[model samples]
Target: MPQETNIPNKSILTPFNVVAGIIILAGLVITVLRFTKGLGAVTNLDDNNPWGIWIGFDLLCGVALAAGGYVTSAACYIFGLKRYHSAVRPAILTAFLGYALVVLALHYDVGRPWRLPYPIFLSPGTTSLLYEVGLCVFLYLAVLFIEYSPAALEWLGLKKVRNLIVRMTLVLTIFGVVLSTLHQSSLGALFMIAPSKLHPLWYSNYLPVYFFISSIFAGLSMVIFEGTLAHRFLHHKMDATHLRESEGVALGFSKAASFVMMGYLSVKLIGISVDNNWHLLFTGWGLWFLLELIGFVALPAFLYSLAVRERNLRWARWAAALSVLGVVLNRLNISVVAFNWYLPSAQRYVPSWMEIGTSIFIVTLGVVIYRFITTRMPIFYEHPDFRHDI
Candidate 1:
């Protein structure tokens, strides 16, 4: 483990920080225009494209990226996989930031950002999958806050308080996992209600299960991907010993990701064949699905094997990144790209530059907050056995 020292203080004006600030400033300007001028002025959303780049990338991809928290928590605390333990704090921090930004992006995407909290108090529709999603998100945010409390306690110089929080953390960990499982799968269930809108190729009763499984693998892959990025760019801030130890975590993640990828690929094929979707193979959507499966799922699974054998964390990390891109594209295709396939290709409602810029801004904001929290807290440098450490 890394020594408990020299964690960098958060900076205000690194190049990436400056870029994020500028983009966010731009987004705030656009947000003002949105409230004043209407959604039409700042977005490419039509009745057909009610959900666009923001929903596709930030909401969908963001959830996949945030998969780290539940997956790691389950492995370490629930399943007793101690080898995966070090990844937990970082994963929780990643999930918290990712989901928080996703929630923000969602508020921006909705027709009435102001009435967003209505679901919590005024409108509770249990029949609707979105209602489940809303409630779970609200609860999970609290759960993540509790889960991450110990790190803050350590930074606050409150060893006794941190110990108390850590003792109670397992309950929060289990609750967070349960909430994540429900919402992650419920995201796919949101589409199941739109059977008429979704293409037959992508729509199925099993979508929730498929999405849930994919999310598990996606979470593991994301940790590997994020950890590698941290090592590359933030190594100067990381304890060298911590950096070396993290490689073992990376290797374990790759192995687990490959296994899950294989299972995912198998099930996807089984789903298609069971539904007799082979007949749709010649269509554009079919080809796109093939690319998603081969380019993202199978290719990454195969490469990780080589990466594991070669002992190359870089290759493993790259494959994880590729896998995440594939997962993002697949989700986007399901929500936007594939949903309106029957419409003419030219009028397919791609995102405007404004929407793209805002999407980038939201993710950048998530990354910045994640960096800020991890750097100042005891997350990366050490695990707190409060008594022993103090």
Candidate 2:
């Protein structure tokens, strides 16, 4: 028999929803202008600054933040931490939607998005770092969906299909981990070739290591943040048991985030020492770098440690927010603020209204989709019929 669950009665016209709808509509209009008028018409981009917020915040940070999917999956499936099983579905959904948004934003950023598939099928730029990132992202997105499909199948009461999906979970999770590891590091590798362009404070030969390591904490922090929201707003979608287990999950995330944040800090310091650029610490740019390292990374890491020790979920959530902010700052520093560091201030690129609008559109779309799916599907709670099977 199919599982019986209580679906929440949510109105589609809340204030937040209305604002999201308006932003989405504006973004649609802006997108139309962008396509018809060419990149020059709606963007502040030029030859000196080809990439802006779309590449930095949308594609780069989006991919990094989505790391929760693989982290949660590996924890439950690979490491045999079944206690975390309840979080797996929501994490996977968040990751799948995040990657989808990254791809959608890329469509608006690229000169000709129709050529997106060229690397996969036609041109196959085997020698390019971007090629590796592209292929991994594309394949990983598919893997995320496959991993997440069991929930959808179960929601629809398709027992046979859901069982088939459940059987494939282990294999799919393995693939997700492998693919995520490659592309997460490869994104940093994309900037390695332009060491001269990136600021000394942020540039390093070990950038790939830095990016991959930081993503660990970043993803975990997001899980804590998102999980908190789920417990608050989507409470009706979750079972009492899931609601109870979520507290432990938040504490676990804090513990893991603290350790990873320490390692990331050490690695970041080592990267600076290796480059023999400690002298740059005296510069203005270096001060900003210090603020990022100390204010966001080190401070939040300490908070996570304290929170976990005290078992204070509230403090942990605050730390998680700061940790997420740290990752966003790091990506933006690398891709935009400190990119082309040697160039004059006037030459630095800033996103125009259209670019910002498009980015917001992508985010709002993700939120709407997440809200829709979690409300309708078996995301927050398992289907009773297959709970034992999963």
Candidate 3:
């Protein structure tokens, strides 16, 4: 049977709920306007900038941050890091929601949302990186669903079914990692087709490598960051194992993320050096690139190192937040900011208020769904009947 949490009935009118309600309502209104009024009514995207924040922030950033699912699960099941097991559930849940929302965000971005499956199913574009990304995302989303199903099954007291899924953990983890690696790198590869459009400093033959490496730290930082939030708002929901291991998970991930960020920074320098874009570093675009590399990447890596050295959870949390921001900054720089660097300010893509609102709406929706699931499921705790199995 599942563990029962003594969750008291709470008011439905809390500040968070009220704000989320408003966002959801606004999202619905925008949804109506978007479908009826078309992309033009809700977005600033044009032929010059067919992709805006919807692709940059929501899709790229969302997928990168969501890498926690594969990272955490791989750490736990595949790498024999059993101490981090408590985090696997929440990480998987976050990734599942993140990918689902990514697909939803695509619907809002495309001219015809209904035709999303056409390229994948009806006429497979095997030669396109996009088709590979689409196929991987589709397959990986299913993999995450299966990875996440044990919690839902356990919550519903389906012991046999839950145990069956649990037995396939290793297989699922391997598959998830393979799929995640393919798509994470492929996303960066998508930008490689337009070298002339993307700024010289940001463009490199190693874009895929950069993206994959950054995602490693991005996923690690997100796990730490999400764990912090869970501990704050949902502390009472956690079992002893989750609560006790939370600090260790944070510290361990901090050390790992710090090292990965250093590697990422090194590779980024190599990319610039290989391309011999040293002269560009003296210019304004180079300054912006350096800021992202040094400020977001290097700084957070140091912070994570400091946190791990001192065994300071607070510093670890801060580093996680900064690293998450760094991933977002990198994705945005590639997809929006740096993509059309030569264009005049008047011609650049700037997301409309409605577009931004829709993003907020999608994120808020994930939060709400997560809250609902965690509050009900055995996500933060092990079920008594299955405690020995895990």
Per-residue accuracy of model 1 over 1-390 as CA lDDT, tens digit each: 233333342344568877878998998888788778877999888877788888888888888779889898888888888766667888988888888888888888888877878988997787988898889988998788778777787788887877777787668878988898899889888899787878878887778887888898899899998898887776766654467668888888888889999998888888888889998878887888888889999999998888888989888988899888888877888898888778887768888888898888787787778778776876767744543331
lDDT of 3 by residue, 59-96 (tens): 99999999999999999999999999999999999999
Query: Best-fitting candidate, measured by TM-score?
Result: 3
- The lDDT-based order of candidates, best leading, equals 3, 2, 1
Q: All models: lDDT?
A: 0.82, 0.91, 0.93
Model 3: residues >4 Å from true position, as ranges?
A: 1-10
Tens-place lDDT per residue, model 2, 1-390, is: 123332232455678888998998999999899899988998888898888888999999999999999999999999998888889999999999999999999998898999999999998988999999999999999999888888888888898887888888989999999999999999998998887889978989899998999888989999999988887899989986688789888999899999999999999889889889899998999899999999999999999999999999999999999999999999999999999888888988888988888888998999999999999998888778876677
Candidate 1 residue-wise lDDT at 108: 81
lDDT of 2: 0.91
Candidate 1: RMSD to truth: 4.8
Model 3 pairs in collision: none
The TM-score between candidate 3 and the true structure equals: 0.97
Question: Worst 10-residue stretch by lDDT in candidate 2?
Answer: 1-10
List per-candidate RMSD values in Å.
4.8, 4.3, 3.9
Which scores better on TM-score, 2 or 3? Answer: 3
